[model samples]
Target: MARLLALLGSINIGGNRVKMADLKAAFADEGFGDVQTVAASGNAILSDDREPVFIETQLERILADRFGFKSCVMVRTRDEVARAVADNPFHGEGPQHGSDKMVHSIFLSQQPQQSAFDDLLELHKSKGSERLALGTRVLYLDYVYRVGVSDLSNKFLERKLGVKGTARNMNSLKNILSKMDAE
Candidate 1:
């Protein structure tokens, strides 16, 4: 079995909530092994013999059928996680000024189109936010306002691009990566 990390979209946010235990059981029912949840926010680590893409497709279908909502999930191998963290575009930059909880990263299903980057930058500019960086498959955002007050929600991007994605704080990301590494 190969170790894989799945960045699941909201399973417990808003009115739609899925129990972690039920989610894990679903994966096992679908033939996955060693299924583990990293956080309550829907990050999962598991071992599966199936191809990542196939597993993702299956999970999406199951989630939609069972939970009555559809969200994008990105699956990556252990090596991909390491590389993604190392490749973070905002490697050395401090958070934007006057911001409480500024750092944000968007996990994409694939490398976004150039037009997507252009659009994201334009959006940030219009909002008077200064710092924005796009990496291989992640977009980092720095905000000047408190994160709760900022309009940079994952739902906004998902609607803008007509795709599904989930956002994670930098600390959560690092912890997930570290756990995967230690495994």
Candidate 2:
């Protein structure tokens, strides 16, 4: 069995609420083992014998069939999760816990096209303070200034790339990795 992290897109937002317990039960019913949820924002860690792509598709189908909603989920293996953390571009800028700088990753279900990449790079050119880097299946966003006012937010990425995704803070990413390690 391989451990994977499923980052659900747009769950519990805009009245599309999904209970973590229900999500866990859904995965368990599908025969996944050591299932765990990090926060209510739809982060789940589970072990399955199936491939990551298969599991991702099955999870999306199950949510639609059983839960009555279609959710775009991005599934990443344990190694991929670790790499996302390790390959961060803004790790050594300042204190990680509490500081003016923070890294947020937009976990995308599908890799954005070249046009989308160009748009992101073009946006970064105008906004030098905001640093954006492309990962294997994630987008690393380094917010050096006001996070609340930055244009490099999750919504911004979605609109620019035209892909469904969910953003996780550095702490949340670390916590998920810790949970995966524990499993």
Off by over 4 Å in 1: 96-101
> How well does candidate 1 match the true structure, expressed as C-alpha RMSD?
2.7
Candidate 2 has its poorest 10 consecutive residues by lDDT at 92-101
Residue 69, candidate 1: Cα error in Å is 2.8
| TM-score result, candidate 2 | 0.86
lDDT of each: 0.74, 0.81
Model 2 off-target regions past 4 Å? 92-101, 145-148, 153-155
lDDT of 1 by residue, 1-183 (tens): 899988888768886688889888887787788888887888889888778888889888878987788867888888877665566555445455422245667777767777877787787777765466777677766554456777767777666655666777666777888888777
- Native-referenced Cα lDDT, model 1: 0.74
Cα deviation of 67, candidate 2, in Å: 2.5
Query: Candidate 1 at 97: error in angstroms?
Result: 11
Per-residue alpha-carbon lDDT of candidate 2 for residues 6-80, written as tens digits (9 for 90 to 100)? 988878877668899998998899888988999998899988778888888998998888788888888998888
